[model samples]
Target: MPHGFPIYPWLCLLFTYIRGLNSTVGESRMKSLLLKPRSCSRVLQGHPWVFAGEVQDLLPGSENGKTVVLRDSRKRILGSGVYNQNSKIIWRRYAWNKVPFSMQFIRKSIEKAIQRRPVETCRRLVWSESDLLPGLVVDQYGDALVVQALTLAIDMRLPAIATILQELTNAKAVVFRNDASVRKLEGLETYVGTFNDQVLEPLNLDIDGLSYQLDLLKGQKTGFYLDQREQHALVSTFAKGGAVLDAFCNQGAFALQCAKAGAKSVIGIDSSDTAVQLARYNAKENRLEATFEVENVFDYFTNNRDERFDLIVLDPPPFARSHAQVEGALKGYKEINLRAIKALNPGGILATYTCSQAFSMEVFEDLVSGAASDARRTIQILHHCYQAKDHPILLTMPESAYLHGLILEAD
Candidate 1:
């Protein structure tokens, strides 16, 4: 029997073993590996974002807006996401489950987001990653859909998303205001145009009993700050019988609300002459007693130090673009809040907000507190406000909670 043994059998066994070993090694190499452990911690901690530094080894070089699989060190699959090496957020996780990222996924996400709120005449249809579709936001204004593509990943998928919006909402037109500065971070150019059909004029919106005319083409953030709708209603409750000053007032949202709430007088100030004219027109359309001024908010505060008001709103744009600019932003916040606090009469109300994501809630509160202390005034917290329900914040991503407002009383 030993004599019948052949060398060919031994060679075959060796080849089979080597092949098996090679396959095992190849599979190990195929596992998605995050380069940085800290990045893995963030993802494992339920955050949906992964920075470029977090990846230990991306199997393939970062391709712009290409879907890639995510895996852990143990050779386990984590999820699927889009890769954008140019962005600080290199990976935007779309789903935790094994689902193909497709138009169907986007449509379902949009539908689910829309269902979260009661049927409103106007609302946000898609809130970026909050809806599990990162870098895309769609606001519904009656028959029109205003879209903002803020990232390369979303911009690449804009056509599919836009088609879904038009088909689902039966929108007369879809307008792409791809003018957000964040796009530049993803190496994308700015663009503004109408999709499907031309939006010839501003669209009229009736929101929470008040009517608003929006210039989808020329206006900011899809023609209005729909996220501030609830805050506007809250301010109206305290605006009655007072002289209200709306600084940085665009289109008279706060001013019109105050006037409609029976405020004795309303003064809206903005640096843009066009904005001032539009605000004045809005007040006139609503039959409200409101005045508009084309002056910079900071300049107005500097020139009129002795002016006093019963109620003042300081809703400024985001002062910080990155974490490094937070200190300068804080200084700016302190300056404006200090002036606004000093301008308020005794027992007056100050409705203030910071739309900066870099400015955390604690930092914003400290800034407000410091302003009150500098003005030698006592401040009482009335209420804390956030973006409306239409702009849903994802629990997994705390960064999505960008808007913060505080109603404070000065004594």
Candidate 2:
């Protein structure tokens, strides 16, 4: 007062108050979702998928591919996630607690995921929800990285992912293999792109002392069946000094492994001509005596019913891509297993696998039992295998355990 200067002028104080009020309103209106009664229980259990039925309300201005807070019916914060109105999975939960989706968090997640697997060779570095980064998968082969962003939020942040991946690993290249059919459910168009260096055709890789060359641009899911590495070796243990048949051999991985293990004869059947060609080339490249044929596996086994093979491997593609396809998928699965059982010599081994997320181990095992009964053969389960160690599964999210296998000896 003595200096004729007011520390807090009336007009200045009014403006400050109004600014604070606007911020509060803006935050509340950013985006928020309320859950129906008992709907937040799944989130409480740490399942990352939030189905549309669980949601009671979406606040105005809730945009697709935007971050939103999830609250229970009691108006208590549960978590936050990337939301999309078009998807049945309204929210792909990224966190269970009130944590900001900041760049620091993203960096730490990517780093931690990379450390989960041995990076000396090809391995899945980031496995979507299993690694706490939902809708994003990154598989590493040497210095090259294959990335798939299944959700728009993750897709939009591909640049960020590429940066973190490249800076951390000094990656020579990053390929976006976004051609998976699952992207359609997220309203995303499929396309392939390389972020840095050009992808080499017939890119060669060494897995368990076996060499495989693949085209990253056109090859199957990240250019190879990396999840079945352990299964390939396990099937080889049964193929030693015996005849081998590998059905739906995408790249002749199993057949080649059997040939390397000194099988009497190895044959690989695949519907894709490109895959057959690749298989033949691999067998030739490694100087292994193995045969590759292009044919529908079901028709081949059904039409050729002679029981001669000592070991048969059925590593089919996903028959049940979605929940609606589960019924038909079960039938298809049973048909193939029955065919293998009927075509096996006495005491022959059958290595069967299903990569469908909808097919649980319980249903798959029951189908196998029914198929064995239909074949009128006595079968004994020898080993049950899962995806390779690199593809870790989340306990709370059973869907993360996508690959299931059972090796059976038949009489």
Candidate 3:
């Protein structure tokens, strides 16, 4: 062997050749998904979803919860996405170029999402598609992080996600809140537990001087609703020196905020007895004077004809989860708004909200308008509200902007 004659150069050349050959072979064997000729525009416009009808064919060897190359009818490579044939959203693009859905990619995505928001004790660290992680949500509560995987792809990689979250947040506990109904679309089961099956005690959080004790295991929507943190402060501005009634008051957040703002009297109504009890506990913990009752808000509005309030807050849960429910949701909105308008004292303020993504701003505004008309009351829109900044909305995805509200003053 001629010592160091030209051996190093030859070896480098051979390695490069083999690497290129392996890359070509890997590309040929990767699963491919083709879209109809005209169906490529939406994906090109940066929208992540490719519906079932848009897909021309998912070539053989494709597997659910795995990455697949997307192509147009003309065989032009469009991008790469996670494929789930069982879901109406057949593909959800994660990259505009060929890339594997590997652990490193997931780690970088999760880290970038967490860095996008302010470092707060309690906040939404990641917001599903808005953060470029479709069907994934992470909420930080003190030292605990609650994660929800709503898609088969993310669900299959939960352990990796947990490890990455623990490393990034240094969280003492990581809980899974995977009970959302949307998981049914991906053919995934709904369940909740901690990472590594470790038990986590109830988490206590303090936001803007208010404290809350939440059971991340048994509570609703990742233990508590972090989206309304901004609205609680915004609505409290109008509560001073007035009687404030918080309807549909889950955990009595609005009622407590009002009491803290020095409202003359604060009353909260909720149908959930447990929620009412928690609300009462929260009021006592904060040393705020507020009354909580376990009664249906609708019935309370209907039966308490003579009751009135200077400020009425109606922050009901989502009424419409799908297009089919939009009609009935509108009716429900009108009924609740009508009763609230009637229950308001002259010149009272009504802070109403809808978390339903199916209802557009125009439709929601129209429903409120119809309610005011039927109740024969004139109102002025004083303020417009949306989810807190922590939950960023992707402009291209309308569904990301789910929570919207209006603060109105009745004359």
Candidate 4:
């Protein structure tokens, strides 16, 4: 309209702006992946992971932390995912369509994940791929939120995640517990940090009427095992007037709950001196009468042959982290179950759990059966437990359901 000023110069400027816009769009377009014939079957079945072997071709510039649109060999659209050339899991699907990897997407995903779980003082907000945000886990403890970024894509977006979480939850602090060994599988280095330059300290939280001091900075798996929150109360229901033993007890959650439930006696054992000391401190903080000892559970069982308990809880860390270690993990599970069965009084209860994703429930149950057979004890399955509701399991991905437990009665 300003023809008098300079019509030719204005037209030239408009053309240049259009070219720049097109260039930006081209640069931002998502890279794509073509999958092998049968590889698409798993993606079609709703699984979210695609290994390197499954990928037929990857577009140029499809590097780690880049989002890719996945397609089957037949050119059919499969989904969109984050590409990681450095990881065996080359692709982690986040949506069934081409989705932009942006702050809005991350914020919406986190919001939806939070909405899925019930409001609680402590709970898992985002559970890795189960919540459609692969390799990202967010756990809330009171006013603090602990996050873990296991994949390169998610790790790169940590600042965005922290900002979104802070905005949504109004949390006092957001701490990163990215020190899990599993991060190595994704080629991520381990380090811990906090959002907003806040200091990481031991947080005192009262969960289910039990007090706990959590060291989110240097503690185990985001300070506490929140996945077993439901199991704590469930196991405590059988503790009244009974002798209780919590093997591999970290911070004495189960033992403290058992003692609070009026158990005749409660003893918690762990190989970590720091854990035992913290457990003792937790017990004293709660004014609960329980014993904490720094000793290997296997050694405790072997040395205290005369010690029998009415209820025993075996919640050990994963003995198997990969498929190669499953056989050894099974043997370890069998030995623990067999020992617990032998150590139980007649009609006593045994609650055992395996956090290893490699061990399926069928495999776990079979091992427990073998243990009972070896111990020559009649075993009755009381309850089959899983991770708490907040840590939901995606039906299609078995790995999402890592924590599996079975309560039994041995006679």
Model 1 alpha-carbon miss at residue 126, Å: 0.9
Candidate lDDT scores, in order, read: 0.79, 0.81, 0.84, 0.86
Compare candidates 2 and 4 on TM-score and give the better one: 4
Any residue pairs clashing in model 1, and if so which?
34-56, 35-55, 35-56
Which scores greater on TM-score, model 1 or model 2?
A: 2
Residue 347, model 2: lDDT of 92
| Tens digit of per-residue lDDT, candidate 3, span 140-170 | 9989989898987777666667778999999
Over 1-411, each residue of candidate 2 has an lDDT whose tens digit, in order, gives 101213353244234334332122223443778889876457768777788888887544336765678888888877878778777788877776655454556678889988877756888889888887879898888778888989866765566667788999898877878888778888777777676435455589887888889677678999888899888888898888998999999889999999999999998999999999999999998999999999999989867877479999999999998899999999999999999998899999999999999988888999999999999999999998899988898888889899999999998
- Candidate 3: stretches off by over 4 Å: 1-29, 40-44, 59-62
Considering TM-score, where higher is better, how would the candidates rank from best to worst? 4, 3, 2, 1
Best by lDDT: 4
Q: Write the per-residue lDDT of candidate 1 for residues 1-411, one digit (tens) a residue.
A: 012223463354345334332121222232244545434467877788777767775544435565666766654667767677778887778888545555556678888877777777788888888888888888888888889988765665665667778888898888888778888888777767776446458866777776777888889778889889999889988889998999999888998999999999999998889888888777677777899999989999989988899999998888987889999999999999999999998889999999998877788999999999999999999998889987888887778889988999998
TM-score against native, each model: 0.89, 0.90, 0.91, 0.92
Give the C-alpha miss distance for residue 98 in model 3, angstroms: 2.4
Instruction: Provide the lDDT at 411 for model 1.
Output: 89
Model 1 scores worst on lDDT over the 10 consecutive residues at 21-30
